[model samples]
Target chain A: MTARPFHRSQAEMLPERAAPVTTAGVVGWLRANLFSSWANTAFTLIALYLLWLIVPAIADWAYFNADTAGDDRFACKSSGACWAWVDQRIGQFLYGFYAPDQTWRVDLAVVLLIPALAPLLFEGVPFARQLRWFSLAYPVVATFLLVGGIGLEGIPTDKFGGFMLNLTVGLAGIVLSLPIGILLALGRRSRLPIIRILCVGFIEIVRGVPLITLLFVSNIILPIFLPPDVTVDSLIRVIVMVTAFASAYMAEVIRGGLQAIPRGQYEAAQALGLRYWQSMVLIILPQALKISIPGIVNTFIGLFKDTTLVIIIGLFDILGIGNAMVSNPDWLGLATEAYVFIAFFFFIACFSMSRYSIHLEKRLDTERRD
Target chain B: MARNASARRPGSPGWQRLWSDERTRGLIYQLLVILGVALFVAFIVSNTIANLQRAGLASGFGFLFDQAFFDINQRLIDYTSTSTFGRALVVGLLNTVLVSAMGIVAATAIGFVAGVLRLSPNFLLSRLVGAYVEITRNVPVLLQIIFWWVVLSGLPKVRDSLALGDAVFLNNRGVRLPAPLFESGFEWVLAAALAGVVATVFVARWSRRRQNESGERFPVFWSGLALIVGLPALVYWIAGSPVAWDIPKPTRFNFRGGFNVTPELVALWIALSTYTGAFISEIVRAGILSVSKGQTEAAGALGLRPGQTMWLVVIPQAMRVIIPPLTSQYLNLTKNSSLAIAIGYQDLVSIGGTILNQSGQALEVVGIWMVVYLSLSLLTSMFMNWYNRRIALVER
Candidate 1:
């Protein structure tokens, strides 16, 4: 009422203005991410061009022009991939020569792995203590289910082949290698010169040679080293060799973890009058193992991929089975399809395992920060 | 108290002292370990002797001198089917060296490019590079080797080769590239190139000193490149260009005249390099990232351009983090080259495997494999250590 409402004492809020289209929408995101500069725009164009060159061709070959619904090679007529070979041999690829009736046992063993791994891998599983007991007994149960003993009809070792063989060897190696690796790592770090030297020697020798040579040793030389009266199964021999190889690598990884722990932790344990094993078990190992989880997982992935090397020693793993399939007259030219199928299997297995490791690492990082 | 003290002395009950005294306990444990190892060795030795005798296999290096009748498709040296097993092994060793060296070169080039591209500011390029790394690394290398072999062998027949001009040809048999035929005067060109390199090194040192004193920059890199290339060209001109190309000529069933790179070599080379390159790219990315952002900012504050900052501030620091793992990657490539056996690439292990089967000398053959590989590993690490020391940071 004085001069005007313009000079009013009460303030009114103004409406929020919209961000400019150039900086705050889909177009803005494209500009920021792909066309931030002249060089970046050019790169984006080139990348798109390259992807255009590769992606559609692969899709056409793998899907559009591909023939997957076939019982034999002759049923495939596409200029692209012939996946009929993969289709017909899928069972053999998975179970090898495992009896068709006993295939359920292999499937059960594989399914049991999830529950066995759950308590060890995750923090909030129900009845985790009881699950830990199952985790401890998983190897025995898996062995009985797959290999058979104690009321189960036994499957001969030769029947174990294909991807089942890979999973069995890899899982067994991963399970057995950890405790041995821990012992070796401790030995390498031991105050006693003899123990340290022996551990160091074992690790260096194993790591220095190729796994192929070790497999050769297992195939031809291991039997020579053993007593003649005690004939170990070839599968068992391979598992033993693979475990030794992985454990040597695992020892070095664990040693890195052991070294990373602050010296004060050990001193503190000693101050509490804890003996060597007690300090290691109660105070040291948990922290070291947590730090080394990524490395442990990496070693497991490597060992799993390396199970393919058993094919070199003439064991019929998945790759071996794939090779055998491709050589058949019905699938003579289907090597590409066979190899791609096998590669896809490995990629899925390894990629998921690596992702899990990264997840665990992030969790550990958050816990440490807290 | 006196009895307790006396019990702790040297005259105590042996078993009690062994169990109670820490020093004695450690000594006993070590002795036990040694004895156990000795017993294990004795058992293995006794068993091996019996087994070898039963199998009627000769043991020792004696078999190495015997004739290796098997033919190796890819041999680096002059070895026929008539060659001794040792010569065949030497040929295999050379082949291994050839592939490893070539694979190392290609892997380094691919790794550096992929690693830098993975961190590109352009989002799409980075994602593409990331995809390449993930897909290549996760797949089994043996499968990759076999896959590549299949791909290579699936190429068109020699009669239908995909020719690049008259100088290069590609087919199922492999690549046929024009080989340079050096005449008498070519040595002078090589000498000139060597001289240019030596001169360039001196000039670089001189230019660096001049920069320190006068703050005037010399274009050392451009000048060095010009010298290396220009001097060689000049010499070649003066020597009448004593080089000729041996381009491939298509024959009835194959190509001749050019250098024939076998399909097995191509497959092994591509697979090993690509596989190891993925690992190396990851190493390189980690190395580069370990160089902090503050470094670039600090360099910028000091008025260095972005390229200069990368060259002078980032890369030098990053290299220290890179070299150790790079050495390991190199060793891995060398070791993985032994996977040549899977695809019949005629590497040391493949030849050795053949020899092992022929001679039935598993012990000796395995021993040779271990010794040679161990030595190779040791030699590589030693060289890498030297290089690392030369580039190491100097601290007061």
Candidate 2:
């Protein structure tokens, strides 16, 4: 038996296996995910064909045939899209009745927002370390850009009704509602019966209603409850309604995050001799917030999309501007093109947010998995 | 000495002492919040009063009973311009309910089919469904509605309307189809139909019980269908066929006297269903994907056919994941139906907006909107919660 074992060789003893190139490369992926069977092969071909049909058509309509810049409809005749409709009314779409020459103020505000928002969204940015100052300065800077004080030409709020208005409403709603939502979530989970009941009641009642109804209340019924001297701007009314609506939803999301935190974390915080607020702020909130980033971003996307509804109230958001484009005598027949343009704008914003959410979800999942 | 030392150790309050303490800090915080809200409310109330006074207008809900001079183009109930504002509002509400109910049913059907198709073993079908979802969901529903309206309106005018033989007509006015008109004994036929429904339910239950006891499958689908549909028709025929068909004919200016859906309603319905179906499809795809491959393989190993495996094993579990998000899509559709206002569909919001402008009673009108919508949202949530509980996993 010992003499027979001496004839063993590496090639003969080991079973033959496919090479790495054959087993794990591009061809393998195609075989596994695409052409796994005859049916799959057919499906892949059909999918490719459909893509070929749609992708090129979309490209042709959006870029190849689209009119990029013009003041009137004649320039866009026979072209796929009259983007000139957007360009001609661009100032009106951006600032509504805001004094045309003073548009720079709004432009400046938009520029400032990038820096303020970048620190908050991107974790690796060093600017985030100065978030306290950034947050404090944001409101003042935004006010200067929008309302025009401190030597800038004053663009009144009534004139501020368009895409910029929609963004402002949505952004303000998110910023104001988030802190309120967090507090409401905390209170709802609190041990104190009174606080818990109050928070729960407010959240439930607000959540029960639609934002339009809330806007109606703010626009109509609210004035009845107020004093004669107090005149609220229409924009402010919308903001208030949006904030209330968003806060209810945000509270629910935050509550879910809070509930997901382990009891051990709470116990650890307590053992460290931290008070309730201190423990929550220091230990619990950061983790809960990270976990809920996807939900928060989703809410932002929803709110942003909903801002288009302002057109119903007679404010000129992007949708309103698009609608207005169709009624122009010269562009009467180009309603399709105008709507397509508006849809593309909305789709870009929403798709980006959704994609970022997926990316964040992956990153967070990896961290947790580790 | 030992007891005194233990009780009075430094400034640490004993549990008993803490329990006896007044909750001043908590009370103050709560009071502050309440005061802030109250002041804000008061400010709004006062401003409204002053503005109404300044405009030389009065504020009250009594205006709801005043004559509404505007006539609605399409109404669910009988309404005239002579009708009171309150009655007109009711008509608008009914129309809203009708459109939303129809939209929900259509959206669910399309969404479910598209969603399941997105997970198809066939790559083409899945990608097609995926593209449909991505394109539709990314665009604003408002834009979609407007686009549909424009497309519908762009169809040839009534003179050159597209005709389906002589029975159906399509034009800017709307699509017209033959409507059924009951002649005689329609009530008896309706009663028979109701009876058929009851019979079908009982038969279904009995068949299930029998199948469980005897390990034999019954032809429940065919039997149920025969009872529910065939039986009713049979009863109607025996009652001397008490229904006549009214086919729409193209007249000089427009098609006359059939079941015509207005272009506005068509556009709204199409937009709502297509837009919402996209989201629903995504939820459906995610739900199917969430199910582990092991389950499918095990079912296969047990010799279950693909259809049976999907229906009996995969779908029931998948529904637990699908139904919750599906509920949100339904809510979204309902809310988005308000976009009909943009096209003058006279939905609840549109009517409410008109009333607000007319009476200068902004506060009252807004309150009504809030109350109505809030109830709607609550009702939706309640239904969804019941559904969720029914399909929810039962764990010990």
TM-score, per-candidate, Cα-based:
0.96, 0.88
- Top DockQ model: 1
lDDT of 1 by residue, A209-242 (tens): 8888998998888888887888888898899999
lDDT of 1 at A253: 92
Runs off by more than 4 Å, candidate 2: A1-71, A74-79, A84-87, A95-97, A126-136, B1-28, B31-64, B185-189, B211-216, B233-242, B359-363
**In candidate 2, what are the lDDT values of residues A1-370, reduced to their tens digit?**
4575554555465778776764478877667777887978887888898889988888888788877776677777554666777657767767777888878878888888877877765668775768757866998889877898678777778787667887788788878888988999999998766789889988887776566666656665655666655678888888887887788788888998999999999999999989888999999998898888877877777777778877766778877876776888867777877777667767888888899888888887898889
Q: How many backbone clashes does candidate 2 have?
A: 18
Deviation from native of the Cα of residue B56 in model 1, angstroms = 3.6
User: For residues B1-396, what per-residue lDDT tens digits would candidate 2 score against the true structure?
Assistant: 998788777767775555444475566667787788788877666665677788787767898899888888788789998988888788878877878888999999999999887887665667788878888887778778888988999988988989898878888888888899998788888888788889888988898799889967777788888887898789888988998879887779876677888899999999999999988888888898898999999999999999989987899899999998888778778877877887888888888787767776676666676677677777887999999998899999
RMSD values, in order shown: 2.5, 4.1
Indicate which candidate wins on lDDT.
1
- Name the weakest run of 10 consecutive residues (lDDT summed) in model 2 chain A: A1-10
Q: Could you tell me which 10 consecutive residues in candidate 1 chain B have the lowest summed lDDT?
A: B9-18
How far is B331's C-alpha from truth in model 1 (Å)? 1.2
Q: Once superposed on the true structure, which residue ranges of model 1 sit more than 4 Å away at CA?
A: A1-14, B1-18, B204-218
lDDT of 1: 0.90
